[model samples]
Target: MIHPQIPLILTALLFSAFFSGMEMAFMAASKLQLELQEKQNSLTGRIITHFSTRKARLTATLLIGNVFALVLFGIGMARSLYPILTAYLPASWQYPAVFIIIQTLVTAILALTVAEFIPRSLFMIRANTMLNVLAVPLLISYYILYPVVFLVVGAIRLVVVKLLKMEFSEEKPVFGLTDVDQFMKKSLYQHETEKVPEVDARIFHNALEFRTVKVRECMVPRTEIEAIEISEPINALRQAFVQTGHSKILVYQETIDNVVGYCHQLAMFQKPTDISSILTPIIAVPETMLASELFVKFVAEHRSIALVVDEFGGTSGLVTTEDLLEEIIGEINDEFDEESLLEQELQPGIYLFSARQEIDYLNDKYNLALPVGDYETLGGLILEMHGDIPNEGTIIQAPPFTITVLSMDENRINTVQLVRQAELTAED
Candidate 1:
């Protein structure tokens, strides 16, 4: 037969678990998810939104409720266990100190495992779901414990302001990057299961990651820049504009490193005789500058093109507003842009790629899991490993991948064929 105290202990444990699980669920639930739900006018969403807005009060309520439940649990546990221990244990174990030690160990083990760990773990796994399921109950609990929570919070604020002389502000933005990022991750996971579309998820992921992208990662390298000497004749500039098919041609003083300005193809209509007459000043920026920062600068300055320079102030590459925009919305090609970069999978796990293809792009698209370092592109990776420009048809081993130089110019690699070793082994 079960003792009356047994039911009391179980009830206390259940209440304790509820408070602990609700607290974990509230903390782990994505704010963006909650915001979206709230927009839909759902009851659970409204309740969660209300509680989330008063986060301090909600947290205080949970803690206070948990303390009360734990106290009841301790009393019930002591009452139920004292009789069993006294009946079964030796005479020496009946001492108050010894019984207290044993009771603490048993209570701690039961409280931590059943009422804390299990519920918190399960609640955190499906936090939004748990919150939605328990929203009504949590709302009732919030009101029931509001007075206690209010006093506790007021006391804390009083101590902080009067004794510690510190300012306390609970103001937080409704949503942040972390909330949006978590929502995107969930969308991507759903996409994998064919439950949602991936396009928006990928775009959001790119936008969130755009802040960390450096100018050098997206800029057109110096070797690929189409520029002419500033001292050159106006006819020479026109010829360059026609041959390169570039609207804006950079103007250099003595060498490409000393870029003075640029001449727009539209300037040709003015019938300028010298290159300097039509030259428009171009802004120079460090290659290490963040792409997002560059975008802000461009918008503020009302400029489109910027020359990316190395630490020595020598020209490293060139970037435009379009390039920065591509970091988020993805590649945007105008009529003047090249057809496309060479990206072709010849066979299973074997492919041809332009040396200019970014390492991150290939790794993401093909799941190549290629090693990344200071380099940004396939050519850069090859150069880093080989330490010199390899002639065409030169085979370079880069573990799990065997890269063959398919084409090259006097200075830079143009294209390469990559073969995955694991695929070849499986075929064999």
Candidate 2:
């Protein structure tokens, strides 16, 4: 039931009531600042734009509203207590203690209930309404009492900020990467029981984690690159290009040392007969290009692979649109992309593999930089480590992965099984 002394009760909490209005006014001013910041919207950019404005509004509103609320509340409480204070006790003790108790209790009630809880809730729910309703009257109140309120409070603000050695700013709340992760975790859907899928949650976590990994961790290395030499026979180049099933080829003049440019296969289909026309240049990329930049370059050029180069004019490796895209989204499979049988099942968290499988590709997936230069693939890396090619069931220690030769042929390493050395984290 509404208390019979509704106005009197409100008047008793008048300090709080006015504070609530002032707090809401602060929120309104903050909203205006945020709108200004959001004009060219970006989370970081908007936050930066609003930072000073938010601080200014928060400070000004807090100061002005607080003073006005204090005055109103002091008057209301004193008006309520004047008679009781005089009648109940001797003059000295009655006035002093009563004034202290009333000031403390009423201030506590106003600050906790009206000023804090109500204003915060209203700001969260209907920021605009709070701003318009509360800020307008409070602004008028501030003007009416500026001489008294401004001088004392301004002195306090200046003194506090200076002594603290901090620039004046309003504290703003923010969420961090880990905080977002935890927040998403708590936001459960009643119908959907599954926490973001093991794969998907990890991917989200990885996207957060992606900022931590640089491009070097996921780039193709120089040794296994299958690039076309300017002098390479047209028939051989064409056969290799077709066999590799790559969309773009890096055409280098000598030893991939003199990279001229790139040729797209679609262009190659048109010039089937002209031997000179077949040699197309490729767009080259520097190894230092971040994953973000590589993506931008790929989008603009409409090309997939770029030859990773060094400052001294030597071919480093290659990166494809598919490779760069992997950083943002998890692994994507194209029609040409095939997963080895070893990948489909996690038998003992391991897989059996053909010894002939290119180990460099294995390295690409796991980031295990094994010794892979002597032969073409992982089997070759093993052969180079051993005096001669080992028979099936041969165990090897390639960083980030462990491989056992399931089978091998006399001519080359044929079939083998492999497993990751570490638990597969999505970021990898």
Candidate 3:
């Protein structure tokens, strides 16, 4: 006849296998996996994420469960052997040696077969899918057993800290911005991980940097700011709006320095007599304001764009919500934006660019060490280096690269060619 303890032993071993697999699955899944799963709006993903975030609690739950299973297994094994020991063994021989030997042999066999090897191997093979399947049951079990698990974890911590006068702190690891950037880029570049795409990774990396970027860094400079004089004819204002491709135009009274407010192009439909009739009061922000802070301000104030002002209260430039977002997510080109504005790669490590391309974009995209102070664009950089308007086809040598002026106006660089020295040497 099968021993009464046999069912109990099987139950314990079954639970042991489950707990082992659960532990392995949870451990093997990365944070990136959790994030991607959550993005997909999966309930299992959310549950796993909840547990992952509370690692200490999850760990305690797993340890408590496994320990309890082992204890049950031990009790079952002892009970099953008790009758045999009493009937077959001599009293003295049955003392501890036979029980110990039998229990150790059984434990070792079960540990390898049921508790350690099979479950772990299966869990590791499909960690994410396993976690998704197990999350619901695991979460249910977690709630039911949480009180006991909490007490056990608390007692253990109390003993380690107070009784032993030791510190046992769990330092959760955090991925730095650089680490995240590299991870996302590599994941996309290799296309090995389907969760993070190239566009998403690039945008995420830029978004991380957006928090630290200042308004001045991405603002359209005063020279580039399209404005209309309040005294100008409505047709003149229409031309300015059409030419600049801006829905909102800065309105100044006497001079561009005296920016009074802004007028939306749609307001032209109202056929107001003057600029003031359609003017909306603009938010003026210091150039030093963080893009993140500016974003919050823009949201709270219901403003899409703000006039970036210097310490003297003169308009230095303008920053829009789009500009701030583009700082994090890359440029958002609309129908209004010229398609040719985007920098083009002519060859490996060689590019064709407008002089108007921001130095920040160049540095971020190319990892260049171009100076930012008193200059904002490649054209500005070339001008500062040459101390004059560079003639068309004139070559200026910057270490590791050379800039050739392709076209220029009297004041600003229109287009240029950039060639890396390494590529030039390779071609030669």
Candidate 4:
């Protein structure tokens, strides 16, 4: 009752899978090409955006070869399997099984392994290099594949999308924002690309910081900032820089908030006898500047920092590229920075300690004062308590953090961390 076109029909179906899978693998190279040539346009840029461009020669080979392969299988199925299967397999059974099993299996295997898997693996292997080489061909793939796939899917989409009001793109591939975020933040992403821990940390931190960070979150308190008075003597100004070791010193009119200008370290020694020498213009930015905008200014100026000021023209605090970077890296320390943090994790959140760091910095970070006094340093507070260093295990109210001493080094308190009992880390 039926012509035996079984083999041909089966082959056609198998071929479709190969083409689809090829499209996916081709998609990978396309992505890489686009990323590389995002700035470099022309045929090169077009190619970079092209689906066939990433792994060009191979993709073109696949595109040409696989298309014919798809036709062979499709013809085989329509002419051969359609008749025989319609006759042999009961109509009820054919509809249930979809009457396309053999072809499905073949194409699925070829597409998964040969077209999709193999090509994607290769593209990733040479991702960076191919980005330059394959830009053009990928674009060709885009144009070639889109219409063909859309034609195949258009009638089906018309029924589902218009009559049924279902929404889906048969020709266009889709992904989510989370996918992009994961790729950017993934450890494997920049493994060989950027190996430095600090650099990696900075990248990760920046990704996280961009979401909702406000200026107030990073601004230094009005009190701790060391400023230069406009009329302050040169010796005092020089002394201030030496003691605080800050690069951009805020030069204020009268009060710390009433800032007028900034002194760059590079120009510090070059300050002439002229009164204007000490009065360099400040790199002032608003508290509302988006982090991304600030990042751009940083790149254009080739500088790593800026000053956050109020609308009234007063200095609020400083923001270094490093500080912004720290939003990702946790913290960046140089050879000069001492690791005065607690030596051990005494408990889940608590840390043991010696008291020697500035009380103001600690108060700023840990809020260790019950009523925060004028006292500026931790060592100063400990000394003032009994006019001497308290012995091991001295209990006192340091305001926010509970003090539990483990050891002391003569007059210097040493070996301590905090209990971080409350939401300390979040508040700071």
The per-model lDDT (C-alpha) reads 0.89, 0.58, 0.80, 0.56
lDDT of 3 by residue, 174-265 (tens): 23456466666666566554555335776776777778788888787787777888898878888888888879899997987788899998
Best by TM-score: 1
| Residue pairs in collision within model 3 | none
Q: How accurate is candidate 1 locally (lDDT)?
A: 0.89
The sequence of per-residue lDDT tens digits that candidate 1 reaches over residues 264-295 is: 99999999989998889999999999999999
TM-score of each: 0.86, 0.53, 0.63, 0.49
Which sections of candidate 2 miss by over 4 Å? 1-67, 90-92, 95-106, 117-213, 217-224, 253-260, 269-278, 298-304, 310-314, 334-336, 339-341, 344-428
Candidate closer to the true structure by TM-score (higher is better), 1 or 3? 1
Per-residue lDDT for 313-367 in model 4, tens only? 6666666676555555555763223455544455555654445455545555544
lDDT for 301 (candidate 4): 83
CA lDDT, candidate 1, residue 407: 94
Q: Which of candidates 1 and 2 is the stronger one according to TM-score?
A: 1
lDDT for 165 (candidate 2): 71
- In order of TM-score, best first, we have 1, 3, 2, 4
lDDT of 3: 0.80
Residue 207 lDDT (model 4):
69
At residue 134, give the lDDT of candidate 3.
89
Q: Indicate whether candidate 1 or candidate 2 has the larger lDDT.
A: 1
Error of 1 at 38 (Å): 2.4
